[model samples]
Target: MSSILHVELAAEPAAAGRSRRVTGRWLTSLCGAEQPCATAQDLVLAVNEAVSNSAEHAYRGDPSGVVVLHGTADGPRVELEVSDHGRWRDPPADNGFRGRGLDMIEAVAEDVRVERGPRGTTVTFCGTLGQCSGTCEP
Candidate 1:
């Protein structure tokens, strides 16, 4: 019995807590208390990166954007998405911005998906939670 928790937040600098809390709630629903810790941390980091991108790149730090996140606990998988209505600029040529946030997200997550365009960008990731026994917890 898997379930989904969907959250929508304003793409402001302050939404960080809201973002984290959403991830936490979803993990609690999906993984309970113990083993989900690491999985939940991954979710937190990924969402943080995505939201930072939304706030800094999407609206270009001016705000006036919305970040919509959805977390799903499916069989052996936990999925997440961060979406906003801000355009995506090309990353610096020399790979200079540091940290490789996107790469880290992809590395830790089992699957990653990105949708980008002139209007906005949406980043999504999914990975196994807990024992990952081909069946998710809820």
Candidate 2:
């Protein structure tokens, strides 16, 4: 069986937290567990980073921009995509504490893909629950 969730909201700093909360809830229900396990928790963190990046860099000076988060859980596999309609912006030079979102996402997710075009930017993250040591089971 498969389960899916979609969320669309203004591209603001708050969107990241909202996406995390919604994704966490959806994952828990989809996994049929009281709460997501360690691997699933890592996936939620990746989802937060993706939405946070879009909220911070995608819109630049435009507060009217929006972000879309879509996720699916199929068997032991999970996939999430976060997209924005604004142009993509390269991460700024590190100040010692910044520019680590993409790196963190790549570290936690089993597979990651990013696409950018005139229409928008989309980041996809995929991971398998079974990759963890029996933590995903309810």
Tens-place lDDT digits, model 1, residues 32-124: 553346667777888877877776667776656788887777765778888888878888878766748788888777678889987689898
Question: Per-residue lDDT for 86-117 in model 2, tens only?
Answer: 89776657647888888899999878999999
TM-score of decoy 1: 0.82
Per-residue error for 18 in candidate 2, Å, reads 0.6
Candidate 2, position 21, lDDT: 90
TM-score of each: 0.82, 0.89
List the global CA lDDT of all models: 0.74, 0.84
For candidate 2, the C-alpha RMSD (Å) to the true structure equals 2.6
Model 2 worst lDDT window (10 residues): 129-138
At residue 42, candidate 1 shows an lDDT of 75
Off by over 4 Å in 2: 93-95, 130-134
Per-residue lDDT, model 2, residue 60, is: 90
Model 1 off-target regions past 4 Å? 34-36, 95-99, 131-138
The alpha-carbon lDDT assigned to residue 101 of candidate 1 equals 72
